[model samples]
Target: MKIERYLTNKMLLLTSIFAPINLAAQERPNIIYILTDQQTATAMSCVGNTDIHTPNIDRLAQSGILFKNAYCAAPLSGPSRAAMFTGHFSHEIGMPSNGIPMPEDLRGLSLGMLMKNAGYDCVYGGKWHVHTPSIPNQTFGFRKLYEHNDSGLAEACSAYLDNNPHFPFFLVASFDNPHNICEFARQQNLPFAEIPMADLADCPGLPLNYERNPYDADVICYEKSLNYSAYPTSHYTADDWRRYRNAYFRLVEHVDMEIGKIVDAIDRNNLWENSVIIFTSDHGDGVGAHHWNQKSALYEEVVNVPLIIVLPDKKHAGAELPQLVNNGVDFFASVCQWGGVDLPDGLCGVSYASLAESGDPGRTHQAYIVTETLFDKGGNTRGWMLRTQRYKYILYDKGRYREQLFDMCRDRGEMRNLAVEHKYQETLNKHRKLLYEWMNYHHVKQIRTEVHLIPGF
Candidate 1:
């Protein structure tokens, strides 16, 4: 009888020891992270933009937490995506531009590696702009899905879902579309550019901030005309600008249709109830804001990106969060929190999982900084932009007019520069101090030597 009692106790102790692990495995949700290239926060109809229709993306927003003030760590692709995968700023990972490969020593910091370590089946498809020499779909411990283009990406993801993956999987479907608008601008191949003036009614109108700001800092002006400048945008007439906007909208609509395919697959497979979906962009395109065309600028059109998180039960559905979120950095930590994995130490991002799950307006960043340290005509000029709820401040390492400040509440278009206004000097000083403190905290140092411009920029 005593031996029997000892055996029973041993069984109970063993069960107790493994109970939490089993529960964690059962509770962990499958994660699907959908990333689109160069898409702005305002591209969706739900975001109050009447110029384009993105019903699929809007559906995600309606069924999740829509971040109204989310920005990328960097406005360029390689750096921005590197930041997203590693939960570190671009500079911290030695990726300050579009094509620079991530440092060899930090490759293990990728989200795929972390998730794979945590026992999730990690798969990736489409563009992997993280500068890893291996194909994007195959690198970072992610099983390859699709490698060609956006359509293939959607098809592959849909088929993967249909396979009924038994394990809690982490899937990433990266799409490239509206990014093609860059080619449209570069080749002056606006489908409607040559249309007769009488038939121009179908084209979209110029943006509210189409005309360049008179008080714009010199650094922005120079950068706008540098690497990605397509066909002197300053010379484009109102009709031409309208055609450019029309092409951009069409590209966005194309990607939206592709996204719909994946959404339909999710529904058909009945994964919606047990899955978490996160949708965002690496950065945003200019789409004619401030007379700019592509990214690598500090303007709202390039820096602000769409971020939506849909929990397993659609917790806090349709909630619009106005808190400042650094999507590039926060994405890693949030996935870790949801996947029941430990967040690595020294990551710069804080998980937004609680906020998405319960609509908890917990602690948020007081200010968010977007950094640029790429090569330009004058050399490697570094720029820093600080954004708070009510104000924006921009500073460049080298430029005639190196500072720009705007009252975001009063000037959403950023048409007026308030840096020199004595009345707002206190506000300017506060933001400056904040930027200085952030630089110090990050241990940022000036890159005096010129970096090689990314090929084909």
Candidate 2:
């Protein structure tokens, strides 16, 4: 047999390099993916929100695992969501803008496509933002789709579960409330509101940078950071911000109610023991954080998203994973891990599903988050950043290059910059190298960082 084993040798070598570490074959679990647009981590009662009641979402968390440090690669809806579907960065998928069609030549495949290929019945209920030329024909491989109907999406999803009793399903429940452009919050009260709130009702105090007007900080820090901008900020005010915040909370409450319906459906159908429920948002909104409204900045409000996963059988139920994780990308990998599906080669994510189940205190890993701002109406490049739990280092390049570093452990609000401080020089340099190395490794473009300003001039 060793006489002519040339191809066999290469095959063995490839297997050695590419074989998955977690080799345990698992039963296919019913997968439910729930994503709310522009909803921040603070909206959930499980994390620390007291303003609006989200008992259903809290129950989902209590019955599963909660991710305390999940961050979105881009804060915009279209790009963030596109990343979620394809498990590829927006830039990599040629979806840099909201209305842009995803290119055909892109080799990226979505979670639905993967699931469908694996023999699961794939379905999409509610928003499908990964628009493409084949869209009218194919909604990324979902055999059934109900796109952009945030109101009745939950009911449609429940109906699907009811209709298909025997077939396993990969269902996506995308809600459109909470994000600004639909004037979702404002239509409930305010109109075309664009100011950051000074305080969140019945919630935590406002961030030091929270603003009620558009200024350098708003443009550079907030707007430039998110992956999508649903609203225009030409006219904004304080009262407007208050009303908008109220409506935003109302939208979240509405979504929470819908979520309960789906959960109840699962319980009613006796599928609770075999289904896996995951709750997360595409990204966070500044709301009133840092004195600006919208996402597109590296502020905690824009990047940090709430993530919870409930696996059947009470496996790793009620565990809190504090380790940092980049959403969208890692989510696909986690799906494969928990669903017992085989993942194709060359995926850029690591599965953290075990952390939810093991409840092992020794589990900890370093994760890096990167955000780049492109040209707006005017031609200008924004900034790039890297964050760890203890230190947040930003490199800003607008017309010229500048740097800002914050010790999150000491000043979690990022009110003070330590890039120029000599004591933190070593830390700054270390993270800079890390960021640079990451950019090179991931094949992402390296851009200069920019200083953030408040919304009002």
Candidate 3:
């Protein structure tokens, strides 16, 4: 469908003018969803990363429950955010890469629409990259607050909250910062703030897995060589990567400064006690891991993102949960459920609300989570990552080394490939079968046969 038809300024004005008055919006506790762009799970100081100081995001971690092993549904922006808002995988929605507009049907089921239908006043601001960088207020059931800049988005969110629109509001303050590291990688200027500077000795050092993985997929090198616009770091030196890491952390901190404003607004307006606040990113950046820079490769640095949830009355405050969460689907499902919306049948997203509200930190939510990516256009070279409790399995189509297995417990750096070892073939086969089952259940008709071609099974 021509999704741009819904995003025009005229349509936005129309949505704002005729939007229903929801002063009596459902009283099922307010929900505040704060999202940042391209922030890795470890970029926050709360995670013990000494290179950055994110006081605001760190405060969220302190006042909420943090999930350590959360994965994105996809590793790129357009597909990832599409999965997030629609509660579907990239392939399910035909949004496998950036710039692919979301189908019209999913728009009606998005978070904003779901909350609105549940009788909550919904408002969205900042980056919505569900194909385009702009959100269509009419279709998504949201009133656009302001533009996509981080500082302005924060100010707009604070002003909106301070004005006290109505009860049970679903507010999305999506900031586009840390994503400026994309420009930093290309040696271009960061649009929002001045890029921080540091000498080689002062900057953070290279990661331990700075070198390429042993027996890594060949498609990675081929795609990098083919797309220098994304991976300009293919030729970067150690000092260069340190400098890159320096700037990336600074950009992350830059966004945290704006997040502080939104958090302060929630407190200033006395919405803290009755609100469910969630903080996360659409996807993660490589941050110099395994010589990788931008996302789309199914590395740990790209898929593992931060998931922090602050429930009403600060339930389980300062606790860390290790449950496996796919924020793309689970996020949509959880927020909708919390807003008192009954989900339609045939949707399989399992919500993490129980885990967050329960007292069992030792609870196991899912055996594993799947993350799929489309690196090249037309799905020529796509990849599926199945992450289990202690192992990570990766499979890519059309690559010489098409499979990689890592014991995540021992090799979090992913420097070793157990898929190459005959002793681990049985374990590899089990993961393959799991992926096969997942694809079959998700109606993935295109690649079921491709998984059978890996030979060891």
Candidate 4:
């Protein structure tokens, strides 16, 4: 009888120890998502751009999972962010450009709504650019909205963190400082100031394809008058390019300072132990890359973006994931999976939650990234691009088909166009087919747009 009693006691002790393990696995951590506006992948020091120093951003990468090949679903703000929120492509929810609403019924419920439904207080501070006026107030489904009304988005986030005290919360701390006046002056109402390039660096390296080439006529004409030029204006002497880059770095530094405030709030509240932090941006700016200013092109200058995620209890800390991840499509699903919420049906993104925990997300198949730009910034259509690891193919057929392809492996700078080259026809055809398959899958209109702008001559 004593032997049986002893065995029973041991079993009970084991159960007690394992019970908390199960509970910890089930306990949902507070989620803090920090989204920056128009930040390129190269801007952050973690991504290999030695020119700029982003210590705070670097720290986040050191303490979390750094995604080396993260990409924006679309290289523009409104559409990219919409995809992040709804987990649906721009067209899937009827949002193809800025200032478009993702109809309430079509929202089908979103990650924020799901978190709110799960009893987590959801707060949004700064840069809520998704339009909803047509549907009236609507709360935009957020429990509390701060809209980063000014340059103190991080301050607002810190305040919100203070008010929450010990509650498990989900906060989207979006900032607009780095976005600045050049990209979308009206989007954030950032007043325009053409700070001369002379005040900045002198001889900043221009994109490889910056030289005025024979084939540049079509693209250059489209951009010169539009203010959304493919590359930065050649008219600005070398010093002009330097000043632009300096201003951009300054903008980034300001945003980083604000990010420090948010981090401080978490530490002060002692929420670090129970909070999962994610940092990224909607898309990238050309900065000095490819001599461009804003996105809307297929080059890496605009398409590639930085992505970092840190989980509580040092889960998957200091890890680097080099797999090509489609942020627009895979981000929300991963967020939902991490938060222990049931994914909204019909979501287009994939979940990296499992691999994130495992620390080594190895690699995945070459996925296609599609982007659509309207002609003249507001017309019916402009162009569409499909980017894989080694190649990028663009179709801009307003009246006649205009196709361009670059072998990224050989011409990482995209200086050479292998599209019309007789020898590379086979490679071009393969990528073209893949792009069409993707376009069809996403229901991209078959109507070909025009090559309104070209930068590399």
Candidate 5:
């Protein structure tokens, strides 16, 4: 079952002639998927964020195709990770909130299970908050190396690679860090290491949209008002917000160091030419955007996570593609394709691997990507975001000004709300119809929404 060097979307051509110590060229490439918790898309230095130093994450971006438009399926740990491994939206899999168990039927068909059942040696090390705190062997199929802890997970993963077999391994090193920012915000002792803050003047300046906008979504205010423990920033001063930003960036750097360990482990085996490396986060932190300190908002900072993929042959190294990818489901698809496994029928994701092979830098695989969020509070508190080529449409189940539209290209900061602008009404309805059609196609009925059927659409 060795894989040949030449690969297509469907399968790897058959081959033979195995080598003992050094793996034969026909063997499938080892897939190293590294994940970090609560990391924003721009948190890495590779994406022009001067506030942080993420050399290890930056190195991956330098050596692979760094996708700028990668978004999470849901902006919470449990639901997002569930979508990622199951190749389905959170609601589709019956998990739209944190700590909810994944459906039993889908558990056996998870990404790890799919790859493991297909003959690849899969190892999962670190945080897996996809309903359960750790991946289950009875269903999820990956060999759990250890429970999630940043202190020794890196060394453990490195040692595993040193002791394991030579070729065709699927390894996951999921780290927990920047997530410690939660503890930092709570004013509790650091779970990892204490992030020392710089002087007030020396700290990174506040983002332009630091203050809540006049037309900010109403539910955002409602959610914050009720969740005091989560949104302590309600009492934060301008200087306090800057310090929070400083700590957030420092936490990002903390995780970056741990990531370097796994990358070094892969490099030690000389697997660069024979392994596929993918790095991303389950969800992104708010990083003090719009007076918000945590995730769950549909802001760009909350949903978009960094994605850097290093293919076995190292093709397209250093290329930053603008493809709009739902890193959750799309990642599930791409991994299956890269590992030479057939995708399960009815997955919403289209593999970026297939799109990348077309050799078109500007190729788009999705008309628009959706990010869903169901609050931890209660039922019917769900919200949805639809991000198209140049615009973002946000809708919530209950909230005044429940809809907001932003022209991402012109107003990347989302300073102005165009949902009320007369001239942009057509554009607004177009996106609303897109969501309406999407909900209908997916059989979503929880939103309690009714979009007028535009004749043309």
Candidate 6:
């Protein structure tokens, strides 16, 4: 009798010990990260752009938390994506521009590898710009599913979800669109531009900030304009710019339909109760903003992007967060936290999961978000921008018009410059100090100038 009692006791103890592990496995949600190329934050109808319709992406926002002020670490594709996947800055990962492979040392730090180590099946499809030769490759630790094009990518992801794997999965559906706007602008074949200007009265108008910043003329913005004639904005009339905007909106709508398919697959497979969905873009495109057609400048149109996170069981549904989130870094941190994976040391981001769950607008980790650009077509026109809730400060490494400050609360268009005003000197000084402190904390070695430091008052 005693022998049987002892065996029973052993079984009970074992079950008690393993019960938590089983519970944790059940709680760990499957992740679906949908990335779009060259999409700005305002492209969605949910965000108040009445001109375009993005029902699928708006559906995610309707059922999830939307970050209203999210910025990428870099303005370019490869570098921005590298920052997002690795939870590091572009400089930290040694990817400052397109057409560069992620450094060999940091390959193990990718989000796919981290999730894989946590026992989740990781899969990737479409438009992986971080790899060399600008093609989909397996070196980033994801199982390459469909590498052909966006349509095939959507089909492959849907088919995978339909199969219903046993284990938790992390699926990435990266689409290329609105990026097609670049080709449209380059080809100068805007359909409406080809039509009679009188018939195009229904097209969108130029951006509110279409006129360039008056104080900044010889900076990186001007240099890029002169160097990349492929954009050809100088030759465009007001009607052509409007047609360009119209074409860009159409491309955004095109990708929205592709996203709808993936979301449909998730719902069809009954994964909503145990899956977390994320939708964002690598960077934004200039939809005729400031007479610009492409990214790489630090304008709000290029730097700010759309970030939507849908948690399982509708946790914090329909919440809008205004905290400045560095999408490049915060994305990996949030995913790691959700997957119950231990993040490595020296990661430069904080997980906003707590804030998302509680729906608190006051919650913020860092006071300001900084974006950097080391090189563009203009060649080594390094620049840094510091964005706070109410103001923006920009400093370029090489330009006569090196400093620009705008009170973003008053001037959302960023048309006015306050850096040269005597009254705003204190505000400018505070932001400059903040930028320097951030750079020092991150151990940023390049573009450190005495001018960035605060003067003794």
Error of 1 at 403 (Å): 1.3
**Candidate 4 wrong stretches, greater than 4 Å:** 1-26, 132-138, 165-167, 181-209, 212-217, 220-224, 227-234, 375-380, 399-401, 448-457
Highest-scoring model, TM-score: 3
The TM-score-based order of candidates, best leading, equals 3, 5, 6, 1, 4, 2
- Please, what is the TM-score per model? 0.87, 0.81, 0.91, 0.81, 0.91, 0.89
Q: Residue-wise lDDT of candidate 2 within 1-457, one digit each (tens)?
A: 2313523553453343233433222367778888887788878877776667898898888888888878776766667776676667777667755676766644336677777777777777776666531234244667555657565778888887777554567888877666643454334332323334435453344445654222223346333343234344334455555555665676677778888888888778877677778889987776766544566566677777899888766567778877767777778777776655665655565566655556664564544556543433333444556777677776544432256677777866667777657887788777777666655445555333332221110
Point out the higher-scoring one by TM-score: 4 or 6. Answer: 6
Score residue 220 of candidate 1 by CA lDDT.
67
Question: What is the lDDT of every predicted structure here?
Answer: 0.74, 0.64, 0.82, 0.66, 0.80, 0.77
* Candidate 6, 1-457: lDDT as tens digits: 2435534553453233222222122578898999988899988999899878899999899889999989988888888888888888888766787777877777787888888888898888887887542334556768888773665678889999999774688888888777878768777543211223334677877788987887763665566665654466677888898888888888888888888999999888877778888999988987888887788778889888999988776667889988888888878877887788776777766566555766777764456788887656666677788999989888776666577898877887778889878999889888877776666666676534544432331
lDDT by residue for model 5 over 1-457, one digit each (tens)? 1112112311221111001122234456788889999999989999898988999998898888888888999998998998889999988868888878888888778998899888888888888887667666545878888787788889888998888564688889888888998888889999876787589987898998887778888888888887777777888888998899999999999889988987888788677878778999998988878988788888889988999888766667888887788988888877887777777876767677655544356664567888988766533367889999889999877777778899988987788999878899899978887787666555676422444332233
Model 1, 1-457: lDDT tens digits are: 2435534553453233222222122488899999888898888888888988999998888888898888888877788888888888988777887668777666686788888888889988888877742246445869878773675679899999999885789998988777877777776453212322334688878888987688776776666556445435667778877887887777888888888889999889877777889999988888888777777678888888999988776767898877777887777777877777666766656566665665755544324545554533334567777888878888776666577898878887889889878898888877776676566456577443333111111
Query: Model 6, which residues run further than 4 Å from truth?
Result: 1-25, 133-138, 188-199, 446-457
Model 6: how far residue 271 lies from native, Å: 1.6
Q: lDDT tens digits, residues 265-317, model 4?
A: 87788775777788988888767554566666555667778899887765777
Cα deviation of 140, candidate 2, in Å: 1.8
RMSD of each: 10.2, 7.4, 8.2, 10.6, 6.5, 9.7
- Cα deviation at 191, candidate 4, in Å, is 5.5
Off by over 4 Å in 1: 1-26, 132-138, 188-199, 228-232, 361-379, 447-457
Task: Count backbone overlaps in model 2.
Answer: 31
Cα miss at 388, model 1 (Å)?
A: 1.4
Off by over 4 Å in 3: 1-27, 376-379, 447-457
Q: Which ten residues in a row have the lowest lDDT in candidate 6?
A: 16-25
How many clashes does the backbone of model 5 have?
A: 0
Task: State the displacement of the C-alpha of residue 174, model 5, in Å, after optimal TM-score superposition.
Answer: 0.7
